[model samples]
Target: MQKATGQDGGEAAVVGTDGTGPADASGLTGDGTGPLAGIVVADLSRVLAGPYCTMLLADLGATVIKVESPGGDDTRTWRPPVHGDMSTYFMSANRNKHSIALDMKDPEQLELVHRIVGEADVLVENFKPGGLAKYGLDADSVAERWPHLVHASITGFGTAAGAHLPGYDMLVQGVSGFMSLTGETDGPPQKGGVAMMDVMTGLHCAVAILAALREREGSGRGQHVELNLFMTALSGLVNQTSAYVAGGAVPRRMGNDHPSLFPYGPFACRDTDLIISVGNDRQFARLAEVLGMPELAQDEKFATMSARNENRDELRALMVGRLGERDAQQWQDELVEVGVPCAPILGVDEGIAYAEKLGLDPVADAGGVPTVRHPVDYSRTPARHVKAPPHLDEDREAVLAWLEGRGADCEG
Candidate 1:
């Protein structure tokens, strides 16, 4: 049923010929297996982190009402990567939800947001600290009015301290010590290619919201859950941060190398790169044999983990010499068959294609567009998608109709 879309270039929503929802929408599920079908979410957040969180909730089966301004979310203007003039950046995270554009400065529009919030089981926002005060939509005010609503506040920092700082991902990465430990040791600190901080923060926010939802069921009350970009970045550093805090070992940039794990990085083969992960001494021994240097396994300077750490350069030089005789894929096939952990370096598109070949089905067809499928696999209740991301204010009439209608479910 996927056909040519309208001028908006969003994924086509092919309902019945009459243009209503599908004939058999017993609930909100496309495949009739959504566990969170009854829950309504008023998504007042914009841009990556917030939208990503709401999109995940929508995939879990919440009816998400995305509130955008007159111009829509900022990512809508991020261009160059376009799908028929649509902002692929915006599409990346805003799927499986309905979008409504409103100007908060307009009293009437502000009332519409309030109406949506009144019915929402969860409210997510990433407004600057106190940015929504003019409209009385800030966390404290909204929480006071709707005591049962789970209010999630995503901020650059806490409300009281560092409130003036902007919550850009790169800045958070730099300040959180992520940049300091990335890239080559001799090179200047570099930010990651993707906005990992934003992604991590969004995931953390989603988990906290889900937890609050569980608590609400027991206590019949909702609490304010707050997460910030910098804090998430700090926690995301994981073992690197632990080394500094617990072991007093300030980690430095080693490029693709792990500070303590030798032979656990990418190396050049005859034609391309293949990454090998030698986690333990056993794996190291197998690697030694694969390189046709079984005698190296008994060399006192390269036998054990500590020894490998001490002679990492010598070990790498020897392996590189051996790998130079075979192409990356050939070596990968041979090493993997023997239980060695390794893979040939692939581009993003190749990775997707490989996932498809492996039957992972990493992409979900929403309406007519393909989106990254939800990472979690629920055997009993699977994630479902009804439509694609909406164009700016494209569903305003339908949303307004639903809002004005006396439907407690907020199917608007």
Candidate 2:
């Protein structure tokens, strides 16, 4: 129930009570008070998606052992933004885990990995479909050896026809039709700023792993959970995909505008742009009142959600003129006061500052490194942040000692 302070002096979320505080020198993995306190995760994935999924498990108090190749994870070299000697990109998804470098092709190392998988509650890997078959780490192989282990595999595409295609976030974005729906209506397709498809696939993989674990409780047996980035991207498209599959409509790029809602995108104010979202007719009426144009809400063309959406061009023209009369912050304050959801577009730093101001601690300390906190808050069992991201082969001795039954303390 205690909170830590960020370097900026802002209070962070409650920690320590459930073993969710900073790491101790004792080499314990977590406080064993988190939901997944006793869970052991064998992380054989690299880069973003698989690492990201296992990181979530680690945050929830799982003892994650990251098995890396001799050169380590690809993200280790993905730098320009480094934290000391490590890549920030690598740190972003690797906190709270132990790392041991091993050549998967070596008989000794492969045997060690089998032992790790034997003791793991979950095994996550993102190799090409059937890539691990040679090493006996594939889902079927692992399931045969460890019937109680949840085996999750991630690929760029499915195991069937698209297995040959490498899965990268931008490739999935383009192939899944996400890029087609981004950017200005008249401009070429665009990819998102971040690796959205990889992130989404990781989230989906986490949910699937959890579900498989829950099912294991009743059956007392584990199963294979397979996910692909292409599918995840398609599902993540959500309403856009629904528009095509169910409504027989193909959605296209419209820049920042919402296809079905008026006043849902950014509008220019006197000094800056503000995003105004008027979800329903009541909110539209309130927005009109705040704009000193109450009659606009009564007009047949803008009276209802559907009507406003139908005549968004005219409504946008009117709203834009009224919004331009004042600065973005002034209009945002007034509109928000009237229950209309609105805000000035904020940069990433400003967004974090706003979250801190709202008492939602978005950052946490992992050992001495600052990383984004887990998104969820549990009343009884909080997420832990006891370890910092490890350097390549950083925890080899400890991990090997634990794996070999040497009584090494590896988990809180």
Candidate 3:
């Protein structure tokens, strides 16, 4: 494990007091390994949003104990593409956490869970509105007992007027107008291929938890944070949302093209499709030169961003004609060399390879399966080696032992 150093050469380290007390949980015990050295997380969320949030925390050196309700997270069985009998979707998110399959229905097991929560610094759950309250683990209930615990809740529509409504990424994409802004003008609305809304909401949850932890440093108290897919989707709509709110225009799907910018989309080359991002007039001018249509830059219909946007269809056809003369890679190289933002749309495998080649290390070997890597990088206290997502109930004994020791010391 490399020491994650900050820009100022300070080693980045976790600051929380692990339930096992200060000395034992601070850093690795003479073995020289560990990422999250002192933080404990009881992860109660399942599927994409909640799991992703905890995974991020785990990647950053938190000791995350994932609590599964017997059947195992539904994602564990969600597979057309399975490795080691594990769903790729589940593998993608639940890394660096010790899994504990407990039947919360059993009163004794439920009591154990309460004890675990009492010893944890953070608790993350994505149950539907009031779903966890019956089990005595909702934010208010848990925070009442564990005042220092940072409790995070993930919901689909949020805990407001829409709390009872179940939120799904595709549904939110549809209801929040994301789908309406995708696809071609005459085509059906298309949701994103990936569950991006869930992913984003997960990211938001992680961010909010970290902020709450920082606040706890001064206040010595924890906070309950709530994140929802609908709100997250709406916030992510960005330009589309702004257009509807301010301009009173319902945006339509424009397929592979920018709504406000010309030539800021994909064009078909001879062998493949290439995405070009001609952001401003200068880029457009450069694009014209690159395409052997330098004269087009001076044409009034395609001179400025506004003018080019107005005549985007015409400009797109012209660019496509010129672009079709060469292969995508060749065109991409030429455009990129001239400062035009462009790329040949690569598949997932190719994207992974590209990131690896650039030393980005997008995924890491967790336990045995490859897990997506955390995006943030620190200099002094660098992230540790990837740990595979745990098998169900894998670390219950060890986690319980650590907690019991801590509880005993607190009593002493």
Candidate 4:
């Protein structure tokens, strides 16, 4: 059923001739598996940051109702890697959820949203400062009405005196000093290869929500939890920032090399590169013996960790020279066998395969839709892949129908 969609966009829900969900829904699985099996999430955020967070919730068995704007989340059309007219960018973070489109500007739709918010156990929003208020869906106002709802907000900055500024992940990384510490210090500061700040913020938000839900067990009330990319980036640099604060040394980018450790980075082998972390003197000795250079461990310049750090350049050169006699994967296997923490640099595919071989379900079927597996695991109630990332408003009519039983007058 994959069709060619032009750059100009279209909505996600494919309405039947008589206006109901397809005779067979192509996307929605509704399997109800995993840890969050019975929870309901009202997702009112979009793009990577918000969508990623809500997607994590969806993966945990939450019935996530993705509230897209009438035009849909912008990434829905960010194509070139499109699948059946859906963008991979959209698919990357948005599996295991149902979509519902609404025009927030319309008063009737706003009323219906309030009804949905009322029934929601959790509500996640990433609207700009004061943007949701225009639609009467702000946290403070909504929480007042739904006392048990865990309302979570993802902002660029903390919602304080300075709330108007937009919160994009890259911008926060640039402004929060992450960019200054990335890449080479002498070279231009580079943004991370992926949207790491956003990823961290999403994870932080999920953690906060889970904590709030635990607290509500006794308190019998939900609290408003807020997370921003800036705060997440700052928190993620815990060790680095703590070192600077305590040691009075602002760390700069060292690239693949470890700043405080030697012989703990990528070294060129005969055919490839491998990373080896010699955590202690014992490990260093083991590594040296494995490389057939036992004398290097006793050498005055690299005897201790401090000495090795001081002579990092020389040690790296020696290690690389020895490593260059073997292939990266071969060195990896030997080092691992010898008890040194090591791995070869793997591309995405190789990484996935490696994870799979280790019995890690790196990928799983999202209701027959191929999707990456969820990161969380629970011993008691396992998360089930109930659904795949829904097409835009794929569940609109169905959701509306369900809402009818809730006794809320839906406006759409």
Candidate 5:
């Protein structure tokens, strides 16, 4: 529940919505309470996926050393959303980690990378299948050198023929059939507003890496873990994919509508858009009553789950007709009081504020930087913020000094 004050007292390693790092660290590196306190991560991933995965690891109290190119993370230049030239995109991840720039094209710099990778407990990357082989950082090569290092790699695709293809999140979103199901039924396919696959892949990769690390506890050896945006997107399809695979159904775009559930997506009210996610017949009865249409519960055409789904359009028309008489908020308040799951559509800022209003504490201060709170909550060893995202290679001197102290025999 404590905020990260950062190890250097410079900036709390946090993704700040305010576009600034927290500069005042409370002078604590945690008392080694986080489950990952002594763990170390060598993060070399760029853009959203890798950085986000590593940032989550860092939040869990890992000493993540962000290894960047001489140009630093490519996101550093994704601008317009900049905090004094420091890309907010970059700040979105890469917190609570040490950073050092090592140009692999240079032999000496590559050597430094090897040294760090050798010492790190975990290494994360998002290069193409054969991308890191030239620098001798491939999973096979690193495994030979450091048998105890957990090597996790993220790719757009697997190491098959598609390995060379770019792994842009939007591309995966479309290619993975998400776009086909998004947007209005009559509109062209549309991708999610955010980097959906990238973040999903990151989350998946983190879980895999954590599982691998746990397995290593017994084997006394590390392993190579891999994930890709394409596979991740497909897996994330969840019920949509299940419907197709299990029932031989091909889902089409149904804007603001659920495939097998009636009144389970967004609906327009008198004022604003609201979501009425009715799950079962009971909730349907509640909703029908709330709308002063108790007859809906008795109507055989809409009495059961299957009937309601089959007649969703008819149901929607009836529900909307009644809902349009009352504003979204008024309906939301009434429905919520009766245990119906519903909410007015929200902006990102409003969502955060709403979480705060509900005591979720969605925001946290990392040192002086304002950042989103960690998504997980550990009863004993919760995630902690300790340092702000590094200013490209800002920790070069310190990291090298620490390495030098570890001596030439740092990692066997």
Candidate 6:
């Protein structure tokens, strides 16, 4: 395994391994073997969306220098759930990167920031439409100064009519009609438990940045990439949005039930609820066999997928009656054995444990902090968990040294 020097000149982490090894001094990993090993990102955004996008790039082996204000990212104080002195929430989206604090109001510090952006391959910011214009760090300003830079901007809404509105995931959920479709049929509109809009927007921003970087290779110039939470929320709604636009049908909440497919939601068993997803007529037939009602697959009422959907009320009654004969775990085992898609409801811990049982290895250690692993795996160049999230201005000295051409690696 390859090793990197930590701030204290001790071994920080083992890089180029499977990421399940001893902790490093720098809390960093990776051996410059990732696909994006040589790339540099100037992360000017704070909070979830911008940080999340930059973290993805960092995992893929980019040298991400997180530029925060003197107060640091707002999430540093979003605590009650913390690790040591850092917020776990903040840590969730910030890893494998170095952090430095700089106040743009200070002319010297702003100059330093400009130098960083000038050297970086990409710049990511989530400031409101014109929030960065005063600092001369906005898209147009950056394009004029650094034509080879990929400038990616994220907002709550587009720059035109909705620029004044603050961007928040829950607010976008309400405005984009996601909340309206999230709850039970009779219940009040509800937001998702997580900030899904922010996450989706981050993913969209990352893709756009990658595309612009690819284009720059061909044209020797970069372009501005823009994304907004409201638009991302609409695109993420997928089928529901299509239902309204393409079919002229407004969708409504249906509890855990799917709008188009029957036998695709949770059903009560003897001891607990189990989700049985039947995607096609053949899967429905296999499910019928598992329930000891093979004849139901041939019945006119439930024979075809459309017929089963149309008569879901009656078919659900029958299936529920049959499922009630066995415990959810028992049914899960039998259904899975026959290739019918089914699983008992699991808590978050149980879900992680299940993934572990299946050899997915969903957790990784950054320095000493535990984190969810990056979701993608590459054959030639896998994602790396280089460093733990930084403390407020923790890497100031090394970053400054690098800025001064000293070539020093940041301390943990």
Candidate scoring better on TM-score of 3 and 6: 6
Note the Cα lDDT for every prediction shown: 0.80, 0.84, 0.78, 0.76, 0.80, 0.83
Could you give the C-alpha RMSD of every candidate to the true structure, in order shown? 7.0, 7.5, 5.6, 7.9, 6.8, 6.2
lDDT of 5 by residue, 327-362 (tens): 899998999999999987789989998998999888
Candidate 3 residue-pair clash tally:
17
Give per-residue CA lDDT, model 3, range 283-340, as digits (tens). Answer: 9899899899999999999999999989877888898888999999999898889999
TM-score for predicted model 5 compared with the true structure: 0.91
Cα lDDT tens digits, model 4, 1-412, are: 2111111122122222222333123223255445655556788989888888889887776667888988999889888787677787898889877888988788888777776666566789898877888776787787666777788998898779658888877898898778888886478888887889888888888888889877876876778998888878888988787778889988788776677787787788898778888889999999999999999999999999999999998888888888998898888888889899988778888999999999998888876677778776788656666576788888888677656644446655
How many residue pairs clash (N, CA or C atoms closer than 3 angstroms) in each of the candidate models, in the order given? 0, 1, 17, 10, 9, 5
* Cα lDDT of model 6 by residue, 21-53, tens digit: 321122322456477765668899999999999
Which consecutive 10 residues in model 1 have the weakest lDDT in total? 2-11
Choose 4 or 5, whichever is better by TM-score. 5
- For model 1, what is the alpha-carbon lDDT of residue 199? 94
Task: Tell me the spans in candidate 4 whose CA falls farther than 4 Å from its real position.
Answer: 1-29
Candidate 2 per-residue C-alpha lDDT over 78-182 given as tens digits, one digit per residue, 9 for 90 to 100 = 997998999999999999999998887988777777766776778899999879999988877777777878889999989999999999899999989999989
**TM values, all candidates:** 0.90, 0.92, 0.90, 0.89, 0.91, 0.91
Report the CA-based lDDT of candidate 3 relative to the real structure.
0.78
Return the top candidate by TM-score: 2
